[model samples]
Target: MKGMFNQFGGQFVPENLKNALDELEKEFNTAVNDVSFIKEYEYYLKYYVGRPNPLYYAENISKDLGGAKIYLKREDLNHTGAHKINNAIGQVLLAKRMGKNKVIAETGAGQHGVATATVAAKFGMKCKIFMGAEDIRHQSLNVKKMKLLGAEVVSVTTGTMTLNDAVSEAIKYWVDNVNDTFYIIGSAVGPHPYPTIVKRFQRIIGDETKIQIMEAEGRMPDYIIAPVGGGSNAIGMFAPFIGDENIKLIGVEAAGLGLKTGKHAATITMKQKGVIHGMYSYVLQDKEGNIKDAYSISSGLDYPGVGPEHAFLDETNNAQYVSVTDMEALDAFLYLTKKEGIVPALESAHAVAYTKKLAHTLQKDKIIVVNMSGRGDKDMDTVLKYLE
Candidate 1:
């Protein structure tokens, strides 16, 4: 049966995992609606994870582009240097409430692993992270960070040795340890409640942006842009503005070279409807329905599937999907670093690359808000190798 997001997400998982998902869904519903639970969550967000970061007006970039006044939602300023911390904190807290003393998660660029480890440490819970072997090589810094924060890092050599494989390994592990362990899904993908749960936690980004933009410009932005892998950060930023009829939501996907190159991860733009990671969404697959390998310079953005919500949004014409090549993303990375003096995660750079194109096509008075999802410090190794 099609669950939430209008015939998109459901428990397309094993029967055992379905039971665990049901329990999680019930607990999440109860906890999210409880006053005490929300208060506790907000408390940790402020005192620990640092909520209400900032909506920075990128005057230099805006002037350089000579079009829309660009504003950046500074999620990079959060404690773990990314918006992933928001979901990590929320899911770990839920695990604690459910009497789970250990948590397991899958990560691509390792930001989510680090976030999960940080929260597990703060909450005194045991943590395990599943990461692809190739991703471990590319994102060693974040891997070390996760390990330093007291996590057991498991390397998955299966599949394409990337995000999709890591997710498979984590799910298999969680199914075996379902009673004592909790799975902290990193993005707004996965089964029904997970997408909803992650969206709720991440919606803070857009909620804060709304208020901050109103305070700064006395109105809503004409566009909100964010990079989409499994679509957590983008959906989180888009959820609050979904009802604003005039506001345009754009999700940028990773196009490794060009669409014709057949190596990118532009699932929403180039793929068909299929089940992946226990959810129905747009996926890159062969004629036999086997998932294909997704390649990108950014480890975090090279996923074969889009979040189910993104699939629904694209179909309903509520959001637009675009692709940026790796070269374009790297160029945007250098541009933002030079102009704004802010280093963006390669994942976020994809959105910046699109913004660089879209902003120049619009009027100078039009406003665009880009969710700067993470800092680039963890991507130093990959970026350096690419530069070399």
Candidate 2:
């Protein structure tokens, strides 16, 4: 709960927005402890968002990996078909409780946007999503999905026309219309309260995993793994076990080509210190501190900068960070679908790939939990084309 400003979570918004952030922080802090708030939130999580998603043991995958046990935290089964829904529902409910009438957000692969739109419909609030022009083209399916749910998706044409630009545009929108608008950032990577807020919402993954592990193995997992884009999924899977010394948290980043090839989204794994989109964190940057371009087959993981909490975690050694290239991730994606009958999102496949590599080093009795952050149905076209 300490101020993480030094690690990229301080006030970075305009003066007019500072008061709103303060109010939001206050509300979030109070809501965390309020019994009625907790109960209501859990109710939505259970009935509306589908809580306690199954944790399945991949026996086939384990056998292929020399019998290294692999347990999947099936976040893909959550509402909206990804972990994004968890934070979206939580934030929308918070916005409603706070008397907000509008919700706005930025998204890349459109999963977050769709999830936000779904919650807005549930709460009957006006919703707007800002996406990069390029993302609109690559993620048109998600855009259509959002529109079907009555959310307006605006395309940002400036800058790189990608996730970062969409976020910048969303912030501008929020600034211009701050009174009744709530900007629901998709990841645990924004300035103050956001990293904390999103992580708290997504912590259900870890919470459920803890109980499942206790019930299944009679012991906690030796490690928890998830892919790191804006780091929400990874933080979600790690937050509940943060204070436990026995559990190790691992985050796999996208090494689009290879780390030295300078084309990957492996921010914390290879980047140096810099500031981007407001916070000081490890960024893929050049000598002038300008963010460098990043590439990844997974649209969700293609970012030049990582979440601030992830940077902090890497620095403090609270978690281990690894990177998997596009080829490696693709292979893992195919392997899971063929061997285990699970088609994993390319972003999530990065963690699965790492898990495969680490199987040789781990004892057969030791448990390793990987978050299947999303389903790969949206990426079937990309996969088919790649294979062709």
Candidate 3:
């Protein structure tokens, strides 16, 4: 029960890694409560990662839709160009506190890898970034950035050559080097301590929003929307407001091609309960429990499982989970860039896609917040190919 989201999360790993995980858990618990540790964390957040980015009102898009006024949580403006830096910095600090000299991570869409490399470079830790070969191709810019940040990029050409496989390889490496290496999981998925740890670090997104929104709107927002891949950004943005029943929460998933065509990453929408990458959650598996390869135009959304907490949330209806097609995401990507002069990462575009649809049908007096998770400079090549 210590590691469960109503039967959705657990250890689920081999016996050998349990002690290491336990140690990490103990250290993490101690560090978060230590006043000096928290001060150091907050210091890096303010000066390095740039906290309290912005909650800008998208006045143009709001007026154009003729519906709810919209606000964009500008996570894209954070250093390293995404919200991934929040957890990256936090976990790397834990690694440092543990006296670890190295860090390992798995990434897709490359934002997490870039963020990991950034902090590792800053803290002078040896870093290894395991990424799917396919993602390496699509997200070459971030791969280059990670290399320039002094990380060794390991290319995994395993199953599907995607995020799921990359995660598999990274975990294998952690298993081999568990004694000395600190694994910084990029999302709110993975085994017990990992999900809890990631959320602890990432909750800054929602915590800041609570204070910022009240200052701006003088009350809570009518709704908040964010994309869920392994559920990091979505949970980070939704966790703080979950108990407030007056505010609505929406989690958008990538429906690549279409859900009907069976080529999407809408795990909570289409998958059944099962274990994936050491956590019990909704996974894209068949009757025999064989995980299917998930497809998405956005590399970040191309995962076969939803985070356990997200599966639990979907089951209990604590928040609404919805789907948006890749075409819809592309349209939203272009729309936001043209309308708001801000380019959203393809992953964030899924949330924007659904937000546009919801906002168009709502009354003008309403308010909605969309977490713009990252900038789009790294996706220009993909967008160009589509335009071609």
Candidate 4:
């Protein structure tokens, strides 16, 4: 298979798992080009997952900012309340096409797990989700939703008991059960084909935004912003616009406390090049190359490594990567809630926070689009604690 992401993405898995990766790549390549497969995927996206999600102009927020006009790509309104379902449904359909009867996935914030479980239930496939024990505790509502959707939620206790550990456990499970199970990775940070596959599946966000923005304003926005954990949503929102030189793409990473405090998940800003979780990317690692634990108030953005394509993009300066603090994201969350009445996911709020800052610096005629990747319903408990 061709190298992933301009030499930034490749399979670095155990020797035993090579064939499975190769097979998955082949099947995904074929499936993407097949008309019937595309049609079926589109059908589900429209009828089941609720496609063509609104691109709403945040007039109140824009007026408050008094600078760039802001528009929100409302992925939060999708069936499962997040952009995750876009990739989840696509991967599940691919698994069914490959004749896999069981699916496995890893999630941190539980949006991905819930999405996977939802698709599995709809398709009558057995599903298991690996999540960190800490995430299971903090994101209890999501865990409950997954279980109610008929998926077995496995709590991982290794390492920091968060996203990174859960991902490692999920990959190990896939390696051990490669034949009959399909592993649906939630982010764009996994091995070869996975980063590519997830990006392609989630790219609908950008594709739709491009058309919707053109129709609404008769031109592309000057900036597109989204939060980057493993970078699926940001990459999805940025891919289609990469060729539009006039459009700037900005990815916001989580600065848990602050970048200067050494307690952030700002991979592109603070990490170095290294391999983790079967892909070569910018990783938060020690001098000995050991992966370090990443911290973020938002579970979805608490990852040590970013997607390989994002690493490449940073290296090539094709897009800009920045960080937002927990306090900044919290302020934006409340600001949007009061100003626009939209409770953005904590992950998405990071982007919103940055957009607000950027809008202050730009002219009023300038436009910015923020991908509201998910809703805040799953984050009420966390938010309430922070508010208190």
Candidate 5:
């Protein structure tokens, strides 16, 4: 499984950080396979985080398309209202076991920050979240929620004042407070153990989907579609089936307008090889290799870079990526909410919009599963104004 990942998933850090990465790798390996870890994780999954979110067959939308059959892996139903909690709970438990008393993280849409703060409260650990000043404004409710949870929300007003800037600030904090602070990255985009660890935590999405599909339809899905932000939800859904070879994995990036419009967040689709956040990855950058500001209707997907693992998968032809414009994504957001009675987050609607397009191209007998990565509660105001 790891071989399919190539150079994209390798550890890329200074010699000084090698030991920490090694320790993290060890903890991840143990947490993933240990019996005690499994038991504890299951307890949280059932009671705290909520697992096995329903695989709801969207007959209405599928029939309306008159193409492939459609189903939703409802990660939106999980506790704290998104898949972010899964990784946050798992990582927080690990931090507690490691004797860490403080948790630090960076968030974009504030979903991950809220999840981290939620877990920190549960674990009674001090929590701090770094967010770009721009993001803090857009996701102010999340900042308020974090404060209510007793977590500090530090606004990063540096370069571009967005996700990457917030991440850089978090890294500086981690460097200064390494002993007592555990940096819990929001997605699978970071270096080494983070990509591996976050992917493992989110892989339950795929695991549950596989079983649900078999029981519900007596077969695996023909294609899996997920929105790509830091690429956690997409990679998580793709990882369990990486070796299957038959399951087509599709990642949808946010194209704010169009790729050529130069206002999109289609990193893998429009960007080139570059390094960012201590890893070699595909970054939305200029000819001089300077990272450019990214735009998306979904703040979560408004990142200027993609996970290295995703870059590798794209290069190796193991997965395919495409883009959805803000208009199309918004259309799908309303389509699902009004038609299916599910208010999907704009981030997740990127996947929905792509799936709707793909559905038209597929046979009616084919099955497609889309990961509903989050709920629309956080995006209601933005979406309502778009409708207005």
Candidate 6:
């Protein structure tokens, strides 16, 4: 699948890793099309990860907004408390099928690390997770969870010490140890096979949402909204609906301090076409084209580049990308907790904040679905410190 997604995705890795990537791509293609493999994956999704997650209508929030009715696609209710598990489970299964006995991954915000660790333990595979030092400090609880699951958590202190740094470190490690180890990328941002593979697994989000929304409203929603970090959740939610021209797809990125403050991760909104993490996409860079450090109160959203597919979507106008500030996200997080008794992940709060802004502009009959990608338990420490 090299140069897939209309030339937007291709393997841009070094010579040493090309063969491994090729092998991965071939195996993934075969696995996805195999009926038995699909059945086994579906079984785990159904029994272990708890498939067909709820689509709950936020009555109080909608009533408060007095415009569009809001429905939450509750991925937060998944076993690992996030949408990351969907991809992790699929990749770990693939790793087992490929006869790999160890799995590795890079994570920010810790949700993906926990999800990866959980699956590795279930399959009895050795797990190693690379996380940014700063993220480790902010998401201490998640570190404990990963450790409890018996995965080695390595703190990466390179380049801004955030998501991008961890990604670089993970890639380096994968390049060196490509024989018996499988690298499970947490998001849609990566080389050819990874973005495609992650998106394929996570597309279950859009597939389920389509059925649930139609049953609930008797029609498809006017818009689908999701937060874009590495673009996994957003791409998953938007993939199934892309062909439906009437349903608008919106991706919200985090504006750390503010967009103009030079401390934001609003990649699609503020970036230009560039390659980072082995795929060409919208990247946060300086005048010299050096990738800049992205900052976001939401650990997951702190990345310098977005997924290649997101860039393609933006380029083709299939979806719109917008941004929400740290303060705006915080307000939405608090508002949801007060109004609906749901505390969303800070990353998810960006989408909720945008929903609040958009709801008031549309008519009351219009419906909007937000991918509540993760719960807030993983964000309590950061939230508490910010609130204090």
RMSD (Cα, Å) of model 6: 0.9
lDDT by residue for model 3 (1-388), tens: 4589898988899888999989999999999999999999999999998898999999999999889989999999999999999999899999999999999999999999999999999999999999999999999999999999999999999999999999999999999999999999999999889888888888999999888888898988999999999989888999899868888899999999998898999999985988889999999986788999999999999999988988988888899899999899999999999998999999999999998899989988888999998999999999999989
Q: How much is the lDDT of residue 354 in candidate 3?
A: 96
lDDT of 5 by residue, 42-116 (tens): 799988877878999998999888899999999999888888998898899889878899999999998999999
lDDT of 1 by residue, 1-388 (tens): 7366787888789888888888998999999999999999999999998888989999999999999999999999999999999999899989999999999999998889999999999999999999999999999999999999999999999988999999999999988999999999999999878999999999999999999999999999999999999999999999999967899999999999888989899999985888899998899988898888988889989899988999999999999999999999999999999999999999999999999999999998899999999999988877788789
Checking candidate 1 for backbone clashes, the offending pairs are none
| Number of backbone-clashing residue pairs for each candidate, in the order shown | 0, 0, 0, 0, 0, 0
Model 1 TM: 0.99
Query: Tens digit of lDDT per residue, candidate 2, span 208-308?
Result: 99999888899998888899988898898998887677888999999998988888889998759876665667888877877787788888898888778
Clashes of 4: 0
Clashes of 5: 0
Q: Work out candidate 3's RMSD over C-alphas.
A: 0.8
Residue-level lDDT of model 4, residues 67-125, one tens digit each, is 99999999999999999999999999999999999999999999999999999999999
Q: What's the TM-score of each model vs. the native?
A: 0.99, 0.97, 0.99, 0.99, 0.96, 0.99
lDDT, candidate 6, 163-200, per-residue tens = 99999999999988999899999999888889989999
Q: Give the poorly placed runs of model 1, Cα more than 4 Å off.
A: none
Report the alpha-carbon TM-score of model 5 versus the true structure: 0.96
Model 3 global lDDT (CA atoms, 0 to 1): 0.93
